[model samples]
Target: MEVLEAIWGLLAVALLAFGLYCCYVKYVHLKYDYIPGAPRASFFFGHLPYFWRKLKNKEVAHDLFIQWAEEHGPILRINYLHKISVVILSPEGVKEYLMLPQYPKDPDIYSMFFNIFGVRFFGNGLISDPNHERWRKQRRIMDPAFSRTYLSGLMGIFNEKAEELMKVLEEKADGETEVDVMSLLRRVTLDIIAKVAFGLELNTLHDYQTPFPRAVDLIAEGMTKIRIPFFQYIPWNRKKVKEIQDSLRLLRRTGEECFERRRKAMLNDEETPLDILTQILKSEAQEGGCDYDSMLDNFVTFFFAGHETTANLLSFTIMELGRQPEIVAKLQAEVDEFVGVRRDINYEDLGSLQYLSQVLKESLRLYPPAPGTVRWTGTENVIEGVKIPANTALNFNTYVMGRMERFFKDPLIFNPDRFGKDQPKPYYCYFPFALGPRSCIGQIFAQMEAKVIMAKLLQRFEFQLVPPQRFKVLESGTLRPFDPVVCRLNLRNPLGF
Candidate 1:
């Protein structure tokens, strides 16, 4: 009888705690009632249930975001439990929040990148660093590596790597074998970044079994998984978490080994190319001491950032070209006119491939790899006649903005002419590389590398999309096609070979 009474007492306490928690969730939900948003699926879960359902159905979260923006107007709020994020879709809001003031990056979102599955990754690196002054210092130190003179010299490396891809594609360009072009594009970009940034020959294009490539894929998967609340704690996720942890370890270890090799080379006065690695080492010397962890932070940051997005850009470009024959013809005509069977495409050739440039810009408008950036606001602000409270996370998404009817005519249509020379550029609405002081520093370098690879591909092959292909976008940290973008290729100039 005494034991039963004790059990009842414990159960009463548990029920009381549950009741208070539900009341708190209800209070917070009512607090942001003024902001327009889809009705919460649950008082406790907020919008997460709807968001997860869409993700589970293989639909990207941004698609749902776009729908909400259309239904509720430009500025809308979303709740992930107690965390309220105000997604700004209006150009005015974007300009005010992103460009006018240097709002700090939302620590809640960026801190997730500092460590994944208990492994250090991108810890206070340039991309993940939230402190404005420190990020500026890091950015200043790394600017020279991406300067015009440095990049102009890199054209040779870019062309060489692109040619390597061409040769690899030639082997499978039999007009029958369905090649996963996205995979090949990723490998070539990986090779290019390894060679150009670190002076290391990854040769991923030829060897498909490289650990580095697999590590990147695993890390991306881990980044996505970390966003799901309590994912790492679940029993079923143990294996997935371990894989992610192991991948992070491999990446950091590789960065450490590379840094040591470079340091030794510098100490021995061996001739080192004026590459990104050399610049990184130089930055350390200028800072007056060795911070190996900081150096490794940048090493891992650049290794992945330098390649992944550009590869996705190329992949999407090819996917669109395969679907639209007229666009391919226009691109081919421009490539042939400017390049004219030239084995080496010079800097001047890149300038004259204007149509190719337009196509790439169009692709970015529709499919930006790094979709959006998040910022934190400390003071209450009014945007688009909507009141956004202080301590709110602001979301600025190019993917959502680019699809809005107000921003583009027939937004779903893939039209390169929208970016033509005579066309008026979209006002503050199109920022694939982001806008303002913290915009991507590597934008020019990425575009140049993409242009070279794309020009060469158009000049060599005629590719057709394999049927039954779903052109679905995958949001694995960065946006990429869910499908592998398989295509059947035919050599354009068979006789020239």
Candidate 2:
């Protein structure tokens, strides 16, 4: 009771003193030198309470970001508990701040990735890691996998998946009923990705009930693990991370098994049938570059990045088409003129459809898969007009950038004419695949996938909105439309196809 009480009293006094000091620093000193951003801290927790990260509505997210931008003058700070990050809003600011050598492209959200995948797999990937030289080398290694002419060679895979999707829709609407276009698009995207990335051709669209498809489904569930943020510090929530890690390991093991089988088949036959994965293997073999682990890393990266964006973009496009009948009708006519009621749309005919391209560009502007991109200052650099010292984290919300009034004439309105031939070039203003030296390599693949799926869907059936047009946001690590987007797909040559 003697020494223990004295120690306890001293500890309490020290804690109280420290807490008071923290309050003074946050509320007083931080206001002057810490850079302006969020409101002054209300003592202990700082400004943590202001972060609306749980927000599911993207419009709300957009509005809040705009508010921050206005107040903080483009670059601003917000505390994620003890970690403080600066958010940059303008595209100009991105070029100025994010592109500078001083600001390294820190995959800041990488901490959120947890154990579902490790830094070795996800972090080492082209999108996540930002070392400019390392990325250049990795991009070169992965280049052949998505060569302009080479990817179009896999058009057959998309055609096959598209036809299968049509067949499933036919069965569901045997006598003309409603079906969820979003779910159907997800399945089709998965199947196409399955064939191109792994060369497995699981046909997840036709049979999602089976084991392989179930595993794929589980992978999607694991992706949703991105939302659980507090799991990092609270050991209790680490179980979710462990569960995701297990799922990732399971999928990776599946990829390895597929890689081995594919290699074996190639060894036995020498010239059976080779696609992107085969090409990647051959490319790696010849150059003696990129070890097994690196290739495997890219295998997972492309496999995941390849499908989800295409699926979500198509889903949103279909939803928008349903809302805008005139646009849908026009798009149908374009599909009809190029493709037909009697045949599938081939690669040769894909380019002739100009309107098809416009619709995709417009939809991408509205709901870009990547909500924001982050970079850290590797050395002292200036951005947009602000002088940023080295090691400062600069995060730009590209999703918000796409909808900025400064960048576009009317930010909220959806118009494909924004991308028409005569329209002024929208260069830095619109970048769904990002921009500059670090722009996405798989953009060509993504565009082709979207076109094929949409062309096929428009040919077979017409989409009509089942919802009352009230928007709901799906915030994956990327953003998507939540709630099974129900649409009426009336089978016809609605595009006169």
Q: How does residue 10 of candidate 2 score in lDDT?
A: 100
The model with the greatest TM-score is 1
lDDT of 1 by residue, 169-215 (tens): 89999999999999988888888888888888888888867788888
Query: What's the TM-score of every candidate structure?
Result: 0.94, 0.87
| Cα lDDT, all candidates | 0.86, 0.69
Q: Put down candidate 2 lDDT per residue, 373-392, tens digits, no spaces.
A: 67776566554566555656
For model 1, what is the alpha-carbon lDDT of residue 332?
Answer: 90
Worst 10 residues of 2 by lDDT: 112-121
Query: Model 1: residues >4 Å from true position, as ranges?
Result: 1-17, 228-230, 234-237, 287-291
* Per-residue lDDT of 157 in model 1: 89
After superposition, the stretches of candidate 2 with alpha carbons farther than 4 Å from their true spots are 1-48, 53-62, 97-103, 117-123, 174-176, 216-243, 266-269, 494-497
lDDT of 1 at 394: 94
